[model samples]
Target: MQQHRCGGGALAFCALTVAGVMAVTAGCSGGSGAGDASGRGERLRAEAAGAGGSAETLRRAADVLAAAGSAEMRTSMETSAGGTRVTIRGRGAYDFRRQLGRVTVVLPKDAAGEEGHRPITELLAPGALYMKNRGAGVPDEKWVRVDTTALEDGNLVTGGVTDPMAAAELLRSARDVTYVGETELAGVTVHHYRGTAHLGRAAGGASARSRGALAAAAKGFSADAVPFDAYLDEDGRLRKVRHRFSFASDGPAVEVVSTMLLYGFGVPVAVRLPAGGDIYTGLIQQGRTGEGGR
Candidate 1:
């Protein structure tokens, strides 16, 4: 990791972005467009095709990732609500060939507000998603495992930038794409691209799926297109990304800004699956019941 470069700033950017938009300035528009959703999608696609530069670069970045066998990344995120803020950061080594890796999250004090500081970690092993919690609140259990055969539907970069593969899919399917400009990141020359994407649609893509952490950074998904920005290194890999969108559950509108960084392409990854002694599966079950405590 000589360059040792990527999305920490992006993650910090995400944290600051979330704080900046803690209060949504506009109303919630969470549907498949107001009218003629499909038709509007087509129009947007046409515009994206005509609007080259940044949009074309996104496709190239995806292509570069598609051929790489593996990579390592550092992911970080911050969320603030009701005057309280939580910061979550992680280090991951992904086996792109296997589409699996382990993400060890560095949870700061009050990272989950009421959840307290927990040294939580996730393992994206084959076919199953597992979590180990060593927090003050967890009761007698250190592991929560999900016997998952298929990935869930959600934003690509949700819950931090654990899965940049989903981000590749987003770049491929984005619309209204534009070139933001060029800048240097981590002392490396990089290009900046911006575009709008529909989270629901991105979820339905053939390659889009949830991974290890169900603790998504995003609160909810909207039918409205969310704004996203990408920073590509000279090698065409994603150095950083920023996604800004709105989610409304039942109360006021809230904005979610997600940023991710990717580097250390083709790095070796080693993951250890926990044993039966670690199994205490209440957390996943609670997540299914919508009372998740991660």
Candidate 2:
């Protein structure tokens, strides 16, 4: 039987793991340029107004992301617990057309061991989901029949597990886009944008509802709503995304801040599974664990 459990503390660990990988592979910088930098506060206020004006801007961003091809990004995560701070990094690549993607994360040596590691690599080709693991390396070559029906049911947001490119597309569709002035990020000037992300129809069908309900039952399955603050370059490509969330039920709030760096667009990279490594194909099947499910 496929037993899935909440990643719980794993969530924070996952975030940190991604952060660590990103820090090493892709240097984490703040901000981008200074072309339009006269009125900072005014621009931020205006941008916030535009985003608050309507949810359509959020939708458009998601659409643009969906239709786009492949993307490579680096991510960083920081979490605090018991007055201790933990960090991690990750690198990811996605192919929208094929609905296939891979994310590789490197964790801090002292943070946690292999048990805390999360590695996702899959190829949605032919008639099934082809998956392998670099961490475990168990199921060398395994195929789970493509459940398009299930994919359709989980909606776009939750379905991202099987199809991450779709998730990226949904995120891009967020509406009310506006420039929130300029800020210095890692020695570069960046334009910030604040907006709401609308869960498009593609992510709201019956299939999605059912799966979502189950996920919610497992760990207070709440719709992921994030007030995005994105830093972009002059070319309009994203440089950093900063946001926070409190998964706590009734305790001190825990904050999760993740920054993603975009590298190559429409470029494809071959995903290779680790040879002679034990594989854990059940990671994705697990639900949120520990307090996160409370």
Candidate 3:
């Protein structure tokens, strides 16, 4: 997430967790660059009595995604309401062995026009989050190094929202899952599955401390199942994922939806930890906020 800020509040926009990072990472540009519902797919369950959808198949698919180790991911999303729409695109690569990864999120070329195209880059290494300068009083040239467990702006904390373990957490927790069939995604034959996860409930069930920001996002989510779609390749690895849901009226009226693509399993990804020079010191407050480069 490039320029707005970092903290629990901005986790939805910047953190590299699942959806947090599966989509690693959105400037949460939050759809400023997204447009039209054309690319925004219709509800998966709304389509048909899925020919290939089954619980066992979905479970195996989840296993494959979790076991993929290191892979490349591409994510896109659109949020729409009141005749307005916001779209986002992001991509990331990770070397799970070293627990290292990087994600970049940007808007459509045309939508970014003269706004200077806000770009958010996040590096997930061992100790901290390497963030880009978001014009938040910090040096705008180098990345800001913030400890993963540190508190931001007195009360806001980064929490586990950016934790890399989130990837496996996503696969293992999905419920009411069903397989939707197979199709070519980015030219590769893939299998699709749909399900929902109550992130709020899950957050509370375990020690998944999201603090205020996460709690708030979870509150806006309803008990109703949020639609989800997953795509798996022949090797049973995850190739794509999509999540669709609507936030509460007090929140953004737009339906919140995100799509993710995965690939390059087992490849090595180089992640460099930022040193003291990379740390931002003055006024530390700033907020900011990809797609598949797979």
Candidate 4:
């Protein structure tokens, strides 16, 4: 539909398929910026005593989320290659207990400067990813279903939106965790922690729903250690988390930084799985991944 720049390797496949459609059309390149500092200095000092937490605390992030039941989520994924950078963003609600969520992913504008592609609606469930507006020849009314366990990056870096629940579950393997400091997110005070997690270990400890996918990711990525930064509220609920993942392709490895922000705890998230007939089972014209045809 537009002048698409489908690069080479895994990133290429992502571009030719989901990533390309979801890549940001325009935005200034820079950090997300720090939270407000209005009164955090005093608050940070007041909470300094309890700010340093052990890795065990970070490992329990998912459990804390499960207790919260659900939350509204915003996701941002950024990557750079050949000096050009692009970002993909998503927002929606999730039911942690049920391991289900819905996200609307926005892509950049096309060469004509108009909206490049329709926002992709993604359904995130236990082990499957359902997408509408996946545009590669399928009718607009049909949805594409992909088994998360079968994806190379376990759908973490695929679908252009990281699953919020899976992202929290991944912290179960937190190692070498250090308390960075206390910070405020959207006015809520949170403790910041940084660390590296081992995918194999996380897979072993992850819930049954996410185990297979994480295991697949462990084998697919070049390294098992994934670096991350996590922020938790006083009640232990995850306020935000950022994960850096490397996907090795035919060319240089593509680095993907996925950030998830959670808020509006206990939000109602109603999602219905698609019926069989609504799924598009035809070939998708995938370029290099052999993931095209059914």
- Which pairs clash in the backbone of model 1? 70-266, 159-217
Question: What TM-score against the true fold does each predicted structure earn?
Answer: 0.65, 0.54, 0.61, 0.82
Better of 1 and 3 by lDDT: 1
How high a TM-score does candidate 3 get?
0.61
lDDT of 2 at 88: 59
In the order shown, what is each candidate's alpha-carbon RMSD?
12.5, 8.0, 10.5, 6.2
Clashes of each: 2, 53, 26, 3
lDDT (10s digit) by residue, model 2, range 1-294: 132221432231132221121132335433223334456434434444663532333334333443556567665555554344555555667654554556554445545433555453444331223344422324545422223323312212111222343333334445555656667555555556666443443235213312342233124213345445665543344445654332442433444455556555666756543333333434333223122211
Model 3 residue runs over 4 Å out of place are 1-53, 56-63, 97-99, 108-113, 125-129, 145-168, 200-224, 249-252, 283-294
Instruction: Kindly indicate the candidate among 1 and 2 with the higher lDDT.
Output: 1
lDDT for 173 in candidate 1 is 52
Judged by whole-model lDDT over C-alpha atoms, candidate 2 comes out at 0.41
Q: Which candidate is the best by lDDT?
A: 4
TM-score between model 1 and native: 0.65
Over the stretch 1-294, how does candidate 1's per-residue lDDT look in tens digits?
Answer: 001101211121121123222221112111111234355334434434564745666655555665666666666554443344444566676765565778876655433334444556777653455666633334555665554322222323233433556555566556777765557665555557778865544445424243222213222343347678887654556667766655443433444455566666667778777798777644222120112323
lDDT for each residue of candidate 3 in 210-249, tens digit (9 for 90 to 100): 2332234354444335556766555655566666655444
Backbone steric clashes in candidate 4, count: 3
Alpha-carbon deviation at 169 in model 3, angstroms: 2.7
Candidate 4 C-alpha error for residue 143, in Å: 0.6
Which whole-number lDDT from 0 to 100 does residue 256 have in model 3?
Answer: 48
